[model samples]
Target chain A: MSPVNSPLAKKLNSFAPLSPDELTCLADLQARRRTVAAMTEIVHEGQTDHRAWILQEGWANCYKLVPNGGRQIIGFPLPGDFMGLRSILLRTSDHSFASLTDAVVTEVPKHRIDEIFQAFPRLATSILWAMSRDEAMVVEHLVSLGRRTAIEGLAHLFLELGQRLSLVDLVSGSGFACPLNQYVLADALGLSAVHVNRVLRQLRERGLVSVKAHQVIIHDLDGLRELAGYDSTYLNGDRPAR
Target chain B: MSPVNSPLAKKLNSFAPLSPDELTCLADLQARRRTVAAMTEIVHEGQTDHRAWILQEGWANCYKLVPNGGRQIIGFPLPGDFMGLRSILLRTSDHSFASLTDAVVTEVPKHRIDEIFQAFPRLATSILWAMSRDEAMVVEHLVSLGRRTAIEGLAHLFLELGQRLSLVDLVSGSGFACPLNQYVLADALGLSAVHVNRVLRQLRERGLVSVKAHQVIIHDLDGLRELAGYDSTYLNGDRPAR
Candidate 1:
């Protein structure tokens, strides 16, 4: 994809308009791209790495291993999402990041980010905006896990992923490429894989949504939103007026 | 309390050394303090308030009202913690902030913060650090709700609160002023109030912890950590060396 039409550029532009010069700087900064196989560990938990990454293609997840030998997927980084932004502030990694599919990612060195921050303060502010939105998403996820029912939790996740991915033209109508399997959904929703399958089947039976292979199609968007109690305000991309 | 001895100052210092001038600026920015009654709503969800607040004394919680008339406590901000940092990025509030007890809070205007961002970039970075750590804590809480047992969840909360409070000298000998009652714990842990009481009784009977009035004392820190699978690395205050 051309740099102007890249997912990263689209996502960042939703927050604020990037100047031509700023876009060029960002493209140059991300020029050193690398590809990794599916299910590859990009950054392991407790591994101290100073470089940051931006997902150029495919999906990735940040997860932690529970004490009871279970895996908990905390955050899903889609195309255009920045991974390991916390590594710039914290000295150590608190969770592991892995590719859900064969992925293309841009590695940004620490010094380059520092230079960007010094030269382009508005760009730095946009980065902060992205990070704040990330925190808001996590907080919403907490609400799902702590209060929502199993069906509601799964429905909420689907609606969320659909909305987020749509920002970068990843969604066509109500359907999108959903690479997550039952096990990953189970870990994220805190349900057994069997329960995840059952929930999906129930949604299908209810004519709310359908999953075929790696694609998820929502038949009744309003019904799914009602069932999940999903609110899109938290995901608003409008910049706060100064 | 003196500005230098304040909990907010101490917490900011953990990220980077604050210059005397910076400390004075912060103190000036927080000079407009207000006292709020116990259980008072500081900021309601969807309210468009641009000002930011720092809890100077007493406890406060950020929570959301679920559709089923239940409440989910998203975060319990300690004495030093900043409330509604998202307000700086998002135009409207996503959740409500209420005082758990009669509290003192400092209001800092948005323009003042913008000036600070331009004048003191290191201090700005420190604020980002605090926000990142807050997100990490919420992710850990999600793990508790999704995977941990009732007992393990309560134990983990206690350990986390203790460690965080200790940073500002609020903790003493593995104990601290835990103002959270059973109902609050119920909301935070996604358990019923009866279940919360039962879990507390179980901890007391096992000689692992004890609660009297509003204080919680941990009998065995190591044993509690082992039981909760607690890791303090996420709460580390060490700043990344520049």
Candidate 2:
């Protein structure tokens, strides 16, 4: 897709349905950008600053590193999705995010954010919706870590990532890039690397899916969904125009 | 304190300084209410119907249980905090909440929420602030679990809980009732009960704090805060004030 029609562009357009003139105004906001290599640390845990990043391409995992060698992957950001929304409300971010691939991102300054929220009230509300959705994801993760079995947690995370990426057209059908590696996956799943490898092998043996290279090929989306007890209701977004 | 002068009542009054008439109107909304026992499962996980719960007294925790014998405590809901904000946006919650103590709570039906939102825009905004704070806490926990050590995670959680409870006068000094057992603490911290016990002992041994019979006495609040790397900036309601 052209830059104008990119998923991030579409998301920004959806929030305000920007006028041609407003889109032109947003060009400066768009121009404040950079490309990051895979494994780039976009945000660091315990840092205090206000830079909201919009992922234009590739994927990333926002996480926190716990002591005792445990890690918690909170959420994955896909194309067109915004990270660092917390900075807007809290003035600081307590989590760190790293790119899963060579990715392009646009970073908007905090002052510009205030201008955008003030200029586009509806968009401001939409951003609030975005934050709310992010919170919902956190809640879901809490459930997965707190309640689901290891297999269930893995299946749920896979299903969720697939569904979210698919929603943004980053994935087609049931397959997409796996984003983070097994090491990062271990942190997200609250398990050790060895344990994560064993779970992945069990998943492959069960004919659920395969993670090779960077691609996750879902053999049976429905079956995996069932195994994960996945439900789509938690991921409500603006309905596509009929 | 009388019902009108209660801390929770005063907290709500601080938002808009409700007039006598408005207080009466709001009081009528909770004319019929019930007190729940500690450990009562008030709201089950995966329920679609959402209710706005206003705590008249006591505490509760929103958490989820995994199939693989794990638990994730998402957030501890204090008096004046709202728990089902996700239901407003996501339509369903995958986490269930149980009271941590004998509590009086008023149930505001989801439908009634809009009326309240419209009736008091500031309160509506306050509700949103409460929701945002919960999201902020989730981000902090993601950091605690993902990056911090086991000891830091437990200590951070303790400091956070104490700070929140202190905000509402739940703690007189550095000591406060924890109201959660080792199993629940393990679930919240993503550690084993044995590990959690060890961490708590470490805290005690270091002259940090002490926990006994569901009560946590923070011997050195500032010391615990430093160990946890906690800054109360996120907890501050620094959202759009209108």
Candidate 3:
């Protein structure tokens, strides 16, 4: 792959510039590119010799199966996002990842991380920036599950997803092509499927948001943001004071 | 701070070896060291000149105030842990930090991170590993909130806290000096104080665990681990395949 054409280059450059040499090094990390179908298990829990990827299209989720029989959705990986990159340091995979939609990914060899850090410190910083952003998102999600009410949690999630997907150009600022069903929402928000249905109904009745035909439409974006106390700072990347 | 005497040097070297040069560089990052009283706000929400710290003694928690008036506890920062370290890449702070117990910390200037990564790639990688482990813990907490039942969540949290504190030698394998009150446990586990009271009663009745006079005693570690589906791999650092 040419450095100029690498999707990762486009992604990281959105936040921090990657020098031509760093871009070439990043492009060299990609071992292959492939598309995975929806509902496919891309990485399973406890798998050794873990692999890493950069998402180029569609959405995916990382999850851990509950001993009681269900799974908890960790976070959604979107276009220009990374999947399994952070887990490269672990001896074994701590969680499984699956596709929420048909997904395209660039397989990056986990072994090249050290080389990248040594040869291209700026690129490594950008990678760390990406991981830090991802970590912030997860922390915010934990807050939602622990503190937000059902209505508030659903609203917060939609606003977050909208802002994130908008950054990747996968959706407009107001709406997105969403593949989540009530079950997915329930798992992510720590609500029951029935409770999720009720919250969606409440949101629709209040004219705050709507989900229909695999798309999420926010009729009152400002209202939902206010209700959820949503802030985009955690998801955004800014110039670091080096 | 002398390199040989830096507590962080001892902590990081437990997982990965730091050369004398890297250790000296690491020691240079600390600007000062101080002790803080309990219930003190170490870092406030929305403060722009965000500072970073390495926890040297006692415990602190990062949390966000919910719009509804309560706060959601994000994670507890223990000895050898980094708080606000990841937020250095962020333009603004998203949450607040408070001391759960009287705490000691090493204030590390954020600007020196670029120099560390450029001069010591191995040390940068170790920092990334520590961050990854911290992120994994947050992910696990999210899983507990989303998927685990009342008993399961509390069990999971206690087991996790015990194992983590044991790593820093603050606690034995079976128990720890826990300053978390019922209110703190309730906030962390997404349960009401009343519900947390009931769960504690149940655990005590079942001879699983006990919390008394600010210390937690685990009578049956295996039972709690099984109930919580606890695994220590996420917290353990292993030799990375380069």
Best by TM-score: 1
What does candidate 2's lDDT look like per residue over A1-242, in tens digits? 45555565565554347666556545556675689999899887656676788888888988765444456778888887888866655445657888988999988778887787678655565666666667778777766665566788899998877766765676766688766788878778777788889999999999998899888989977788888877655555534321
What is the clash tally of candidate 3?
A: 0
Give the Cα-based TM-score of candidate 3 against the true structure: 0.86
Tell me candidate 2's TM-score on chain B: 0.87
Task: Show how many residue pairs clash in every candidate, following the order shown.
Answer: 0, 22, 0
Give candidate 3 regions above 4 Å deviation.
A1-32, A47-51, A89-93, A110-124, A238-242, B1-10, B13-32, B46-51, B89-93, B111-124, B238-242
| TM-scores of all predicted structures | 0.92, 0.74, 0.86
Which model scores highest in lDDT? 1
> Cα lDDT of model 1 overall?
0.85
Residue-wise C-alpha lDDT for candidate 3, range B125-224, written one tens digit per residue = 7787787677778889998888889998999888888877766666765779998999998888888999999999999999999999988999998898
The DockQ ranking, best first, is: 1, 3, 2
Question: Model 1: runs farther than 4 Å from truth?
Answer: A89-92, A118-122, A238-242, B14-22, B89-93, B118-122, B238-242
Share of native interface contacts recovered by each model = 0.53, 0.34, 0.68
DockQ of 3: 0.50
